[model samples]
Target chain A: MLSVDIRKTLGAFQLQTAFDAPEGVTVLFGRSGSGKTSVVKSIAGLLTPASGRIALGARTLFDDGSRINVPVHKRRFGYVFQDSRLFPHLSVRDNLCYAARVSDRGGRSPDHVADLLGISHLLDRRTHALSGGEAQRVAIGRALLTEPDMLLMDEPLASLDGPRKAEILPYLEMLRKETGLSILYVTHNMAEVARLATHIVLVEEGRVVRSGAPDDLLTDPDMVRLLGIRDAGAVLSAAVTAAPEDGLSELAISGGRLFLPAVEAPVGATLRVRILAQDVILSTTRPEGMSALNILPVRVLAVRRGDGPGVIVQLQAGHDRLLARITRRSADALGIAEGTECYAVMKSVAVSQTDIAVGLQSGL
Target chain B: MTDWLGPEEWQAVLLSVKVSFWATVLSMPLGLICAMALARGRFLGRDVLNWLVHLPLVLPPVVTGYLLLLSFGRRGPVGSFLYDTFGITLAFQWTGAALAASIMAFPLMVRAMRLAIEAVDPRLEEAAATLGANRVRVFSTVTLPLILPGIIAGAVLAFAKAMGEFGATITFVSNIPGETRTIPSAIYAFLQVPGGESSALRLVAVSVVIAIGALILSEWLSRRVAKRISGA
Candidate 1:
């Protein structure tokens, strides 16, 4: 387990956050300047918090009230900065081997990490000559070669384009499945959070406002407001119940069933689907002759006022609550309120296969 | 040109080369240490230390030589201590000429090295620390290699300055034949005579050529080292 409880005051900004993350991918999700990087720095022993303690597994890395602060070199946590920060003086091969050579772990080789990160072909090239995605791969390989107890990645994909991010995501998934290394990933992208995060810690202005499973947290309307409309959504884990004759796939979520456009997963395989808030429409009654394939009976749980003249309705669909944002005028005309029955309509094509990620149970 | 320069001129040229080479070799490490301290070390009276290191650059060379003589001349405190303890003398000696040359070149060396150290990114040091390298190892591995170009540049500047040092050397260690009479002092002595103008002019040309050669060598070394580090 990696546990952090630290408090630091930098000028007017005060950071006091506490969380215990089991050995998997625990993501720190927040907007820019939200002190996520500060927390990572404190864990790496680069920044000394004013008071509190940090522990990795059985080791007490810092306890400021007791005057205990481990030096950075001995912490043994692999840190991958947003910029990749590869040493320009070294080749890709040398960069990967550097930490392993210096680390106390005896005889750890660079070839192991290179193979895991799929960077063997780029080893001999200089770091400056690599593309952005390739540089990030080399950076990941360099970090893993240290044989660290945990990996801390701070927005490693923020600098890449969409194609580059897609190119690297599968490798990250492979790393998550293959290695038993615990990872603490920080990113402002909700898609990345849904794809990689097992446990999510939502940080806002230097404080952790909420923490829970990614599936539950993504559906919360307050989280939607925090994440903004462009990226807000509900993450649902579903098991493929049947591959229907019409080439569509039937998956069972908590309270209802969803039919996606077409899924390649065999029956009984699990997939995660993200239903965007903007793509959902609500009706008081089950309407007939609608082109939308999935419509679930739901009860209005709460209504939240969103920024810029919009209303966010929280609906209890089976055991999960999903958020739908509509204009305030639409909410009033449709009478979206607490304790009202409604049908939540989501188009079949709106269920993006790219949003569907297959999670491995192995701890990362 | 060969006929114009005689055997005495050759001796002065060879002696100057030897003295300047030793002077540069002995003081280069000290220059690096002083530059590091000035650029990165934080402590009380750091500004004073910076000012003291650069004092030789602003002060008259003759005054600096006079101060060295007062402190290191025979019967002077340090000079007498050295003589009594180890039978060594500095006043009017060839070693004294080297000491004068090193002092004159020290400021130039420290300034160049300071700029180089300042150019290195401290973030790289922090990155090294995260990779399990201690402070000393980081310096040897990261800091030293990055600042090597600057160090070479500073050494070359000091060497060129040491080769041409005249006022301080003549003042601290008087013009003694074959011991303290370097190329510049010899040229000065020859110019004072009735028929020694041509020889003095020839020695001046030789000094210019040596300075230019040192500069070109430093430039090539800096480019090579920069390419290696930056991977361009």
Candidate 2:
């Protein structure tokens, strides 16, 4: 377990947060300028907090009250910066082997890490010649080769374009599955959070507003604005139950089956699908002859009114909670309230291909 | 070579090479230390140290040499102590000429090295530290290699400066045959006599060729070192 609790003041901005992240991928989800990087830096021993304590397992990394602070190199936590920060003077093989030699972790070999990161062919090349995604993979490999107790990534993919991000995400998933390395990843992008985060800590204004499993906090209606209203969505863990029939595949979700437009996943593969709140429509009565392929039977959970004409409604279909944003007039006219039964309608094409993540080998 | 240059002129040319080579080599470690301190040290008196390193460049060469004579002449305290303790004499000796040249060229070396150190990003050092290398290891492994071109540049400047050094060498160590009479001092002596212009010009041509050769060699060395360090 990696636990962090600290308080620091940088000029007028104050950082005060506390959270315990378990062994999987714990994502610090926030917007830009939300102190996500600061939190990661403190945990890596790069930024010293004014007070409070941080510990990994039984090891006390820092304790201001007792005047205990472990220096960065001795802390044994690997850090991957957004820019890669690879030593330009060193070859990719040497860069990966650098920490391994200094760290005295002879268990990890350069070839092993290179193979794991799919950078074996690029080992002899200089860091300046590698692409952005390839360089990030090399950086991650370098960090892992140190045999650190935990890994810290500060927006590792933020600098990449759409295709580059796609190129590197599978490697990250592979790392998450192959090695049981605990990761503390920071990002302002919700797509990464939905794809990789097992535990999500929502940070806003240098404070953790909420912390829990991604399934629990991501569906909360009150967090719509924090999640970016336009990008605000719900991630539902589903299994590919049937093959494509007429360019549509079926998924078994918590509530009922959802037919999406030609998901390329194999049968029995678990997928995480994100549906935007704005795309979901609510009806008290099931409408006939609708072009939409999905109409989940849901019971209203909560209604949160934003400072606008629309209201964010929480609906529970079976054990899963999903969010739907509808106009206040439509909500009032349909008499939507807590415990009210309704049908949530969604079009097959409304779920973009970019929003689907093929989860790990094991189902979510 | 001897058809145009006399035996005495040959001795002066060879002696100048010896003096300049020693001056460049002997003062390199001290130059690097000064450069490192001036570039990265945050301690008190840092600005004073910087000013002192560059003082030789600002002061007249004769003044610098006179000051050196007052402190390091044979009868001077340091000079007397060395003579009594180790039977070594510097004043009016070949070693004294080398000492004078090193001092005259020290500022140029330090300035070149310091600029190179300043160009190095401190973030790279921090990254090295994160890799578990200590402070000393980081400097040797990450910093020293990167600043090699600068060191070479500094050494070359010091060598060329020492080769051409005349005012300081004359003030500190008087012109002595086969000892203190370097190429420049030989030219000066030959020009003082009647029918000596041809000999002086011959020595002048030799000095020009040596200086150009040193410049070209230093340029090539720095480029090779830069390519190897940057892995380009």
Candidate 3:
């Protein structure tokens, strides 16, 4: 377990955050200038906190009260910056070996990390010649060669284009699963959070407002406000119950049944489904002859106004609270309020297969 | 055919080369240190140190030479103390001429090196620190290699400036044949005599050739270093 409870004051910005991350990918999610990078830097010992205690497992990395502050180099935490920060004078091979040669820990080898990151072919090339995705891959390899106890990635994909981000996400997922290295990933992108995060720590104004499983927070109404109305959604874990012949697959969510576009996963395999708030339509009574394939009988739990002209309706289908956004006029016409009964209607084709991600075991 | 250059012209050529070479070699390390300090160090009186480093550039060369002579001449306080303690002498010697040339050229060397050092990204140093390199090791392996082109440029500028140094060398060390006489001093001597115009013109031509050669060599060295560092 890696735990950080730090408080630092820099001019006008005050950072007082406390969070314990288990041995998995704990993503710090927030908008820009929200102190996400500050928290990660504090954990990596790049920025010293005025007063706090930082510990990783049995070792005490920092304690301001005791006047114990380890230097950044000796802290032995691998940090991958957004710019990659590769040594311009060194070849890719030398850049990968730099940390390993200097690290006090003797377990990690440079060749092993290079092989793991799949950059053996580009080892002899200069750093400036590599593409953006390739540079990040080499940066990851350089960090891993240090044999750090934990890894801190600060928006490593923010500099890349969307396609480049897509190219690197799978490698990050592989790193998380294959190495089982405790990772503290900082990102502002919600799509990455939905795909890779096991736990999400919501940060705003230099403070952590909430921390929990990704599915729990992704559907929370308060979290929807943090993520904004356009990106609000419900993350549901489902098991592929059956693969029907009509290009649709039945999924068993916690509260009700969901039908998604045909997925390649075999029957009985678990998958995650993301149903966007804007895509959901609520009706007071069961409608007939509609093309929508899935409808859940739900009770209106709460009603709240969104950022613009829309009203957010919280519904309890089974054990999950699904959010739906509709204009205020529609809410009034449909008479949607708390304790009202409604059928949540969504097309099977609208439940995209790409949104259905398969999660691995917790430790993996 | 006999050699075109006369004996006096040849002496001036040889002495100028020796003086400028020694001046550049002696001042390069000090120039690098001062450049690094000015570029990287954050300390009290940094602006004052910066002004002092550039003082030789703005001040008249004769004034700078006079100051050096006051501090380093055999009879002056610092000079006399050294002479009394260690029997060292710098007044009216070729070494004094070299010292004057170095002092006059120091600013150019530091400016080139400072620009080069400043051009390097500090983020790379931070990255090196995270890689477990100490401050000294990071500077040696990363900072020095990155700034090498600037160092070469600075050295060449200093050497070229040392070759043409006149007012300072004459004021500090004086013109002594076979001792403190360099190209500029020899030119001055030939100008003083009505019959030595041809020798002075030939010596001036040699000076021009040396300056051009130094500039070409510096360019070649800088490109080689840049290519090596950039791995291109």
Candidate 4:
């Protein structure tokens, strides 16, 4: 576990934040200029806190009271910047070996880390030649060679485009499975939060307003405004129940069987699929005519009316919770209230390939 | 067959090369250290030290040579101490000529190096620090390699400046033949004699060739270093 309680004043803005980072990927999720990056910098010793204490497990990294601030290099934390800060002068091989030369802790060989990140082919290439995603992977590999107690990633994928992000997501998932290293990922992207966050720390104006498991906050109606109406959604723990039929794989989610566009996994493989609130449609009563494939009977957990023309309706479908972001007029017309039964409708192909991701493998 | 340059002219050419080489080599470390301090270090008298470095460029060459003669002459305080302690004398020697050349070229070297160091992104150094490198290691592995092209440019600039150094070298060392007289000093000597235009012109051509050669070498070296660093 890593503890951070830091207060810094930058220009006119004052950043005061406190949080505990437990095991697994604890993401510092916030919008731009929300002091998320400042918090990460403080942990890396790039930015000093005015008054606070930062501790990593048994060792204390910083304490303003005691005036004990360990230098950045000795802190032994791997930091991945938003821009992959690879030494342009060095080959991929030499760049990975840099930390090993100076550090006694956890510097692994370039070949071994390259194999782990699937970047063995890129070892001889110059860093300038690699694509954005490829560079980030190499950056991750270089950080891993440092053998850090925890990884600090400050929006590692923010600079990449859609296709590039898709290419790198699998490698990130692989890291979670391959290593027991603690990661404090920083990003404002809700999609990344839904996909990668085992724990989420939401910051607003330099304050952590919410902290908990991804499942709870994702489904909470209050978080809808922060996670933008279009991006806010429920993440379902699902498993492949049947093979692809008509180029669609059937997944057994909590409410019912979900048929998605051919998941690349065998039957009984567990995954996490994000159902964007905007993709879901609410129905007052069961009607026959519909082009949509999946419609589940849901109970309205709560009604959160927004300042805008929309409303985020918290829902319960079997053992899982889902959120449907509908307009206020639609909510009134359908009379969605707490415990009110409704059918949540969605198209068979609506769940995007990027939305469906790998999660915990619970005896699958 | 032996008409390319007079024997004295040849001696001057070789002496100029020797003086310029020593000047460039001896002053390079001080130039780099001062440049690093000016670019990154924050300390008292920093502005004063910066002004002192560029003083040679601003001051007239004759005045600088006079000051060197006063302080580093055999009878002067520093010169007497050196002569008494180790029996080493910089006064009226080829070494004194090199010292004058180095003093004149110091500013150019420092300026080039400081610009390069300032252009380097500090974030890269920070990244190295996080990778478990101390300040020295970070500088050696990251900062030094990144600024190598600049260092080369500085050294080459100083060498070229030292080769052409005239007023200070002549004023301080008195242009003694085969000892302190370099190419420029030899060119001046030939111009003084009646009907000596051909000899002076020949020495002038040699100086031009050496300066042009040095420029080309610096350009080629800088390009190669950049290629190796950028890995393109």
| Highest-DockQ candidate | 4
Question: Candidate 3 docking: what grade?
Answer: medium
TM-score of 4: 0.95
Can you write out model 2's per-residue Cα lDDT over B1-232, one digit (the tens) per residue? 8766899889998999999999999999999999999998999999899888888888998998888788788789999999999999888899999999998899989987887788777777777776677788889888887888889988998999898999889999989989999999999999999998988999999989878987887677667556655546
In order of appearance, the predictions have TM-scores of 0.92, 0.94, 0.91, 0.95
**Candidate 2 TM-score versus the reference:** 0.94
lDDT of 1 by residue, B84-157 (tens): 99999989998999999999999989988887788777877887788888999889888898888889888898
- lDDT by residue (B117-218, candidate 3, tens digit) is 887888888878777788898898788988888899889989999999998888898999877889989998999999889889988888898889988977
| Selected candidate, larger DockQ, 1 vs 2 | 1
CAPRI grade of model 1: medium
In candidate 3, list every pair of residues with a backbone clash.
Answer: none
Query: Which 10 successive residues of model 3 chain A have the least lDDT summed?
Result: A355-364
Off by over 4 Å in 4: A358-364, B1-3, B222-231
What's the ranking of the predictions by TM-score, best on top? Answer: 4, 2, 1, 3
List model 4 lDDT by residue over A55-160, tens digit each.
9999999999999999999998999999998998888888888866766864467688899888899988899899999999999988888899899999999999
Q: What TM-score does model 1 achieve against the real structure?
A: 0.92
Task: State the lDDT at A192 in candidate 1.
Answer: 87
Model 1, A162-235: lDDT tens digits are 98998888788778778767899999998888788889999988899999887678877777768878788777
lDDT of 2 at B109: 92
- Assess each model's interface with DockQ, reporting 2 decimals per model: 0.60, 0.51, 0.51, 0.70
Show model 1 residue runs off by greater than 4 Å: A240-252, A255-269, A358-364, B1-5, B223-231
- Give the range of the ten consecutive residues with the poorest summed lDDT in model 4 chain B: B222-231
| CA lDDT for candidate 4 | 0.88
